[model samples]
Target chain A: DAGITQSPRHKVTETGTPVTLRCHQTENHRYMYWYRQDPGHGLRLIHYSYGVKDTDKGEVSDGYSVSRSKTEDFLLTLESATSSQTSVYFCAISSSGGTDTQYFGPGTRLTVL
Target chain B: AQSVTQPDIHITVSEGASLELRCNYSYGATPYLFWYVQSPGQGLQLLLKYFSGDTLVQGIKGFEAEFKRSQSSFNLRKPSVHWSDAAEYFCAVGTTTGNQFYFGTGTSLTVIP
Candidate 1:
């Protein structure tokens, strides 16, 4: 639970539509990350932010954008959703940097048709 | 390139049986290794981690992982399996100075009665 929450626990969207998922954390962790989970893929990093307004692309960041305007909130936006982007999204936070343990929030299941 | 290999995609063990999940990673320098477990419809939870310390690391839920630098492996083991331990286990590797993590495909554990 880690005091993390993801909005839109489940959603079904049409292809080519825009979608945004929100992650809010009460813990003031310095690092936040977005990951997508899929069958056979396990979990892959999509994007991550180390501080407000400082974000970096992950292994699968194409077609996705992220914003971290504040310490407690990180946003993931898909400009135009595709079926391939349909998967479970998870938000994670760590007190320190990458080497530290990460606590994950309940995931958001997105479906694109 | 960094990669994590989890040979077993699924494992079945009876209750009270011993369990071991294999994880191997490819990284140049000293790597940060971690094990995480996920239940149905739940977020990933940290089982244990190995940064630098004793080769054996203890984790939550009576789980332990042995880090073998020689073999580039960090294998998770539990002496007794519980029915509640049926879940998906993932192994991840992170760099000491980076914020990205590479995760394994994950192994699903089934605890049979």
Candidate 2:
């Protein structure tokens, strides 16, 4: 499990509402990533943080933002929730070593009505 | 662009039957490959990874993968399928420099009684 926990394991929100999902890791890893899993899409990277306060956009970064103010916490926020944004969000962390194998959190299922 | 391809969207195998899931990657350089499994309502778990050394890599849950550089494939295989093995499998490729990974659409496996 890599000591990773995601808050709000399940959430339901109305359209136009803002929602934030938090991923916390105890290992103090250097890399943290936010990904959304959907049918036929597998998992798509929304954003990732390589270091504290150092974040970068991923292939599907529109309408989503991430912040890593501290090493142990990474937050993903949806400015305005939409039905299309409903999916399972996962947080993963990888060590600074070159292995590139990531440990994933359980995941958060979000529904936008 | 680096990408992963899982040709089969779904597969069915009888319990105790041998199983193989195909994965092909498109990358320019020597790539880092990985296999992950996701159960219902659960997070993705790392099965195994191939970086270098021997082409055959062993993973958890009685799973193993072989990396074929010539074919750009890292197919996951198991000698006997168990009902517990029913889940979605994903194949991913990472670049040499960055930890970012690209994942396949995933294959859903069904173990028949």
Q: Encode model 2's per-residue lDDT on B91-112: one tens digit a residue.
A: 9987765668889999999999
In candidate 2 the C-alpha lDDT for residue A65 amounts to 93
lDDT per residue (tens digit) for residues A1-113 in model 1: 68999998999999999999999999999999999999999999999999999999999999999999999999999999999999999999998866898999999999999
Q: Over 4 Å off in model 1, which ranges?
A: none
lDDT of 2: 0.93
- Poorest 10 consecutive residues by lDDT, candidate 2 chain A: A94-103
CAPRI-wise, candidate 2 is medium
Off by over 4 Å in 2: none
TM-score of each: 0.98, 0.97
Provide the TM-score of chain B versus the true chain B for each model in turn: 0.98, 0.97
